[model samples]
Target chain A: MDKRREVAVLSELDKKLINLLQHGLPVCERPFAQVAEQVDSTEDEVIAHLVDLKERKVLSRFGPMFDAVYLGGAFTLAALAVPEEDFAKVTEQVNSFEQIAHNYRRTHYYNMWFVIGTESVEEIEQVVQGIEEKTGLEVLNVPKLKEFFVGLYLPV
Target chain B: MSENNNIALTSLEREYIIATQKGLPLVAKPYHAVAEQLNISVEQVLSMTKDLQERGIIRRVAAVPNHYKLGYQYNGMTVWDISDEHAEKFGQMVGNLPFVSHCYLRPRFLPKWNYNLFAMVHGKTPEEMHQLRSQIKELLKDVLVERNDDSSQNIPTQSNDMLTSTEILKKTGLRLKDKTA
Candidate 1:
């Protein structure tokens, strides 16, 4: 953890920017412009800061938060226990899909866990099967049996 | 809104949501910033965001935790060997608890493992965490607490990615030391 990157050391303006990005992108045609206006800066400045933020790695990828159910996209959370030797190859294959958003190699029996957001349940299952068949690993379909309130709130 | 409604998302929408999950725009018109990036009107952003929230597509958009910094010193990932018949009942009941932040069911790795229900709890210290666990125990005494067999290791990779990292997990506390790993 870069002490410098610690959110506390940031300037109020930057803090506000972090807070803004934390909640979401401003909903406006000229969002940066709108944010610029709010922070009393130019739209260009807001965009620049975001780019810098990404460079710093504080902000991961910047874009959209999809609602799979709404847009009719079928998505699922799946995992596979890839042998340590095969981890790299399996990951390369899994990440190959545009549907794989976030993948994590965690410590569990079923290790290389990933999320796939696609267009339909059948399609999602088919993709899962393909990954398993190709990787020669069991892909566990741990779909959310029940939707629970998943809120990541860290009081700033 | 029948909270169960799953509205599939557009590629553009998915991109924006992933980006913003870190945190929403703090600007007075945060939605406007999003609209600008998407090359759409602020009004459209606001309307869609509202729809997402209403549809439970995007859960509450808010600030995430720096657990260690916040003094939530202990975290525990508790699993239950719940029978399939009552798994949903147990999961939903446990999920609704204020302290029980996250609850979910995963396919059990049988022969070797059979715990199906998993939950994550966070507290200021080991004692606090233990106390919370006891409370959970009293509530779930009927359900058998699965023996934790996995060695400690995992987190921060996910913790490092705050927004999209909000899934209910199974590690907490001194385990947080392993978090940075």
Candidate 2:
């Protein structure tokens, strides 16, 4: 946390770039230039700021956000309650599977939660079953029945 | 259109998605770079991307900030056990909240799990999140109270729990099949 406080402060230009980019980058040949025009910066400067931001670890990713479901794949949020002593062991076993996309240890009974992404809908179960067999823990598979909102944009 | 619609994607669109999934190059002409890779014109790449956005295949082409680094360290996965009859409408209302990044109605595993409505809230601290949670509780109070009054069998009308992430055990980007053969 202390390290984050000292990395770099966002300048007005950086702030404008983040604010504009969060909404989206134009889908054109010179998208950065388009963005620069909107942000009062040159194409070269916008690209430089973005590169600097990425290098500083401010932006995790910069690109088109693809819908996994639309790409003919299946995804789900699953959880497992692992014992304190076996947490490390369980993590190793669970992460061994490539299908596990994002795993988080939360403060709850069902502590170990992860998003599983598979090539097809049927494979979702197969991957969950494999994890159970390997980890010896019951997986509480909770797929989203309905999604109300998803996009997140924080102004800088 | 619904996200689950059976919209057939052309091969070119598939190629574009696979190529740009990792991201576009941070250059003066990012789409031009993508076009060169796919052996297509820059205009074609741009139009295809626009088409994908219109079709809801691509949510947006944007910069995803590292929330933790951006001072939004406290994130709670708030789950609620709202009645099935009103979950849809209630979920929509909850989703419209500014702090709620993701709102969903998911299946509940009985006996162990009873939560169906999940809304993920992002904040700088637990106190900030507590404030947001109270807002949600306030919004759902009337509905819950009405549910309890309506039926004696379904005693606990609505209940919620917040799960804060302690550690990121594993994280990987969703990868697509390579079709540049």
Candidate 3:
């Protein structure tokens, strides 16, 4: 938690506004105006607050969240257990792929977990195999068989 | 919803997705600005967005807060080894929890891995996350016990491991229909 990067304080209105925006923004011509009415602020004020929130790093991003699967793309959660000495080299090799959307170092034997997204299932396999060839570590490719839910609701 | 519609996006829809994948304009009239950029009507932009949402191609147009920046520093990828028969019911129950962000039933590779259900949890601190983990453990205790009795293998009946992220190696939004193959 870097104090300099985080927002020092959130006004009551900002809190309420964040809570409202999480559900979603209206899809219309005057969308901000609609949000303004609900949050009891002017349209301009709502837009300004959104900009300020993003700049302060409170909001990582604000936009349409597209589903890659629906768009005919494929993705998988894969991991590798890199030896302590080769961690840096392995990380560099794994992240070199543009298709590797996200990679995280977790505290476990299979320490390096990452997501691979590509145009199709074939591409996903190629990337996974390529990773194994590059890192000399077996890749644990776990594709989601079923999504119970993706409701990422964190109460502000 | 049928995830694989196999219906191709119209040229207009393709343009819309490519334009907004970077994110909608953070202005009062975001859609209008988008329409202006694409030389399309504002109504067409609104209608297409609605259609995409209905089709599940677009999950939502909303504010994605930085959980770490918002005081949620403790996040864990909690993995559980639920029996195949009871996974669906249990996974749904875990997904419904307010603290669980994303829950999924993924394939488990034998010997090295046995966990099938993955749930992501975030909290203000490790202590807070521990409390949430306890709640999850309590919820799954009964099923795990039942599973233990049915199994004849020498494997211990222990369940669940929380993999806390030590570092974020790389992160970037997936581009729409990226042709990097």
**Tens-digit lDDT track of model 3 for B10-116:** 77777787778878878877898789877989988899899999987789988888776667776799889887888889999999998898888898776567789
DockQ, 0 to 1 scale, candidate 3: 0.62
Docking model 3 quality class? medium
Residues B1-181, candidate 2: write the lDDT tens digits. Answer: 2323344788888888888888777877778778887899888888888888997789999998877667777778998877788888999999999778888889977656778889999888789888888899888865552223335343233478788987778878988778555
Every prediction: chain A TM-score: 0.67, 0.90, 0.91
Better structure of 2 and 3 per DockQ: 3
Ranking of candidates on lDDT, top first: 2, 3, 1
> Model 3 misses residue B64 by how many Å?
0.6
Native interface contacts retained, candidate 2? 0.73
Give the per-residue lDDT digits (tens) of candidate 3, residues A5-88: 353378877888788887799998888999999988999999898899888878767778887676567778899989999999
Model 1 compared with the native: what TM-score?
A: 0.56
Over A1-156, each residue of candidate 2 has an lDDT whose tens digit, in order, gives 445433347889988988788888877777887888888889899899999998887887899998777776778999998999999999999999998999999988888999998877678889999999999999999888788988787665
Runs of candidate 2 with Cα error greater than 4 angstroms are A1-8, B1-7, B145-158, B179-181
Question: Model 2 lDDT vs. the true structure?
Answer: 0.82
Among all candidates shown, the one with the greatest DockQ: 3
For candidate 3, the clash count comes to 0
